[model samples]
Target: MTDPISIVSTAMAEDTLRINTIGNNVSNVSSVGFKAQTLSSKGDVHSDLINNSDGRLLRTNRKLDLALQGTGFFVVDNNGQQLLSRNGSFSVNESGQLVTSNGKFLVQGRSGPINVGIDSFSIDSKGVIWVGDREVDRLLIKQPNDSMLLATAGNYSSASSREVKDGYVVYQGALESSNVDVAGEMVQLMAAQKHFSLMQRYFLLYDGLMKNGINQIGKSK
Candidate 1:
């Protein structure tokens, strides 16, 4: 049989990891385009764990900000490389080109970069970026599978299918809010703290038992 110390140790470690994840999610609640990461059991057996989940989309109506309804990401040019993001709090650069909140260029149709020079633009239902009366460019929307995107695009090599118009469209002047649930995270934090305290007590009791057993053997010998 596995010893109590070993069993409880594993439980405590897993619980700690879960606690950390919950705290991170709670902290990033106000972060725009923040996706909530999750921890789940991979199998019925203990120690089989997985950490990843798709977060729900939140809509915020703010002009120049765009949000995807479902199953897509807006492509942004971070430095010279393209990156995927859902955060749509955008701003007009000095040169009048549309850029992300952090000043990264929003990729145009995946063919080349877009330059909306001193022009107002509106995204159409088909992800078209119309600058005034002329159609300037189209946005690249992709549905990532297998893995989530990193902060940069150069190292992101996930094989994802391009998201077409399957109920996914650009909502101008709106940003996607972080999917973290504060109430849920608080509940998990409480549970994890309780488990951690219980584990500490158990560990202390197990150590005392071993010490007592060793003393008894010494006296017997």
Candidate 2:
């Protein structure tokens, strides 16, 4: 009785969540170095718990650009805490330290933030920092676990601590491209729309059947 309705309603709710995730991916299609997020449903019990996966790699030609080829994250310091990100859109600050577009200091070496004193800098393949041809600090690149979940505040939660790489590469004058595929997103959009429509039809049919049953009982009485 109520089971079917509950199933349909739960399915509809999950469909809505899927639509929202798809919408976000579509909106960020042209975002520089943006990673496309893929959503997955949890459990066979029709629950709405969804998870996302980061996919694909892209290349950008900005002199301040950076891209991580393998599984690693660039360490960023927001206030006094550390944040991790794959986005390599970077710039040199007045102090000559490499920073993100948002002005957060990029971590270098296994040590704390490296302070730069000049106006010119470059990152080599080994993530070493070059301040006008002089090696100052190595970029603090970390290889987080694959199952680690990256969250807000530029932080990540994983079973193991992040791996520091003294030899990870960072290319200046290039950016990593976004991972979203337009064709795949469009196909997902169509499927979600169809599922939504089918659920709505089922809801309507359930309503009509209940109404007819009530009307017949009243006539018999």
Candidate 3:
């Protein structure tokens, strides 16, 4: 028979992982464009992270902020590596190039890096950027064939294959709120904690049984 102690220990480890994941979700509940992650069991021991991208839109009413209303992501050049994100909070850098709020990654446009040049610009529903009367560029919005295949880090996701998605409407002066359900997470966390406690009790019970059996053998000798 398989050792009960080993089985209990494995269950405890899995519980710890689940609690940590729930904690992370709760912490990022207010992060802009953040997606909630859920752990799906693969077989008996392994699990996979599935990100939920169904977040609600928040109106910021700031011209520089942007938001998507449908299935698509804004493309950003992260040091030559293109990354996709729903985070539309952007600002112009020192060189007049549009970048993320952190002033790190450059926001990509149809031509290349967008340079607003300190001029007031407006983005239409179709992702077109207009500076005064002339149209400068359009934002790069793409949707992957399978969003689950992309690796997610915070509000950004990256994949090798990119396909331009024109089905989405871009809403300027808004952002996407995180999709984390705090109440649901709290319920799951409580269940995991209870399971962990039961597993710990089983472990202690097995240890005591082993000790008792060894003591009986010593008495016989």
Runs in model 2 deviating more than 4 A are 44-62, 104-108, 146-161, 164-168
Which candidate ranks first by lDDT, i.e. highest?
3
**lDDT (Cα, tens digit) per residue for candidate 2, span 1-221:** 46878888888887888888788767877665455655567654332221223434445556577766655677777676666676777776787666878775565556666666555666778777777878887777776554544444233444444766554456666655556787998999899989999999999999899999999999999
User: How well is each residue in 50-122 modelled by candidate 1, as lDDT tens digits?
Assistant: 1223345455556576776666777676566656677777777787767776675655464566567776668
TM-score of model number 2: 0.81
**lDDT, each prediction:** 0.68, 0.67, 0.82
Considering every candidate listed, which one attains the maximal TM-score?
3
Model 3 regions more than 4 Å off: 44-48, 145-153
Sorted by lDDT (best first), the order is 3, 1, 2
Candidate with better TM-score, 1 vs 3 = 3
Candidate 1 clashes: the total is: 2
State every prediction's TM-score relative to the real structure. 0.81, 0.81, 0.89
Native-structure RMSD, model 3: 2.3
Kindly report which residue stretches of model 1 are placed more than 4 angstroms away from their true locations once superposed.
43-62, 79-81, 94-96, 104-108, 149-161
* lDDT of residue 11 for candidate 1: 83
**Which digits, one per residue and each the tens of the lDDT, describe model 3 over residues 1-221?**
99788889889988898998898889989988777777665547555364645678898899999988777778888778777787889999999999999888899998999999999999999999999999999998876554443344444554554656577889898888888899999999999999999999989988999999999999999
